[model samples]
Target: MDPTPPVPHDLSPPRDVPLRLRPPRHRVDPRARRWWLLRALASAGAVTVVIGVVWWLWEPARPWLTAPLVLAALWTAARAVVEPRVRYAVHRWEATDLAVYGLTGWLVREWRVAPLSRVQTVDAVRGPLEQALGLATLRVTTASSSGAISIRGLDADLAAELAERLTAVTEQTPGDAT
Candidate 1:
């Protein structure tokens, strides 16, 4: 026998059990597309502008030096334009009797949960950009260092309703934390 005792978890398979760890699936409103597009454009435009200015000031490098930066900025912008849609497709949320779960992130997937009893607060915020786009962000705070769960690009009304529902549930349900 090996010197060290085999840990229980070490004996388990590497593959994740989707039903247990996987969050419930739900897509965001289509308006998220427009918001993402505007965000991408603004970000890309700023980068491009900065590159153009730098190229102008650093005359020796001329067009060659800034060419790569311009191309990269455009590519990043393009990706940004499509990011929201991809994120929306993968976004999932479920409020069970035990807890509220929110799954977000595009390239780096993150699954977060906040037990109803442990929920310290729930809020819906809409900034100027979100207002213009008819969107709002839902934030749920728990007593964890992992921090709050922020779901952005939700329809304004839906966010508001979810916030209210979360508040009600948090009040009625008991937290399962030790």
Candidate 2:
């Protein structure tokens, strides 16, 4: 007889499980669209200013650069208009007793789930822009290398509360969170 003890059914990994990820139920705050728009505009404006300066200083290259500058401006304008709305619609997150789920991205979507038992840390982050907009991102770090999940564009207060709740739940859950 083999010396190894039989693995418990509760702990055994599922075999040939089909992958089906449903979208998370909670949508990010609506203000996130405005924040994204402002950010996109600021970035595009900065690039345009730099290009304009170069075109003004370098007379000979102006003819060659004009096309690129125009193209860039058009692209930026289109993206600034469309991307924010798309991202706002697509980004959703939900936290439960068992797991945290997130769905993010516009063109390329990603869905993430982090079980409470494996969660190692919970943090709420606010950048200058996020602070200005009164928004925050809740980050859940798990034991796996690719297990970090960021639920962005949450109301600042809500994000903080969520982080605290997740921390408390993970602490009580039975696991090394390693």
Best model number under TM-score: 2
lDDT value for candidate 1? Answer: 0.71
Query: Which stretches of model 1 miss by more than 4 angstroms?
Result: 1-20, 56-58, 175-178
Residue by residue across 1-178, what tens digits does model 2's lDDT show?
1132321212212345332355666788777887788787788867877887899899999999998888778867866898888998799887776778899988899898877888988999998889999999999999988868998888898888888878877888898988
| Cα displacement (Å) at residue 14, model 2 | 21
Winning candidate number (lDDT) = 2
TM-score of each: 0.76, 0.84
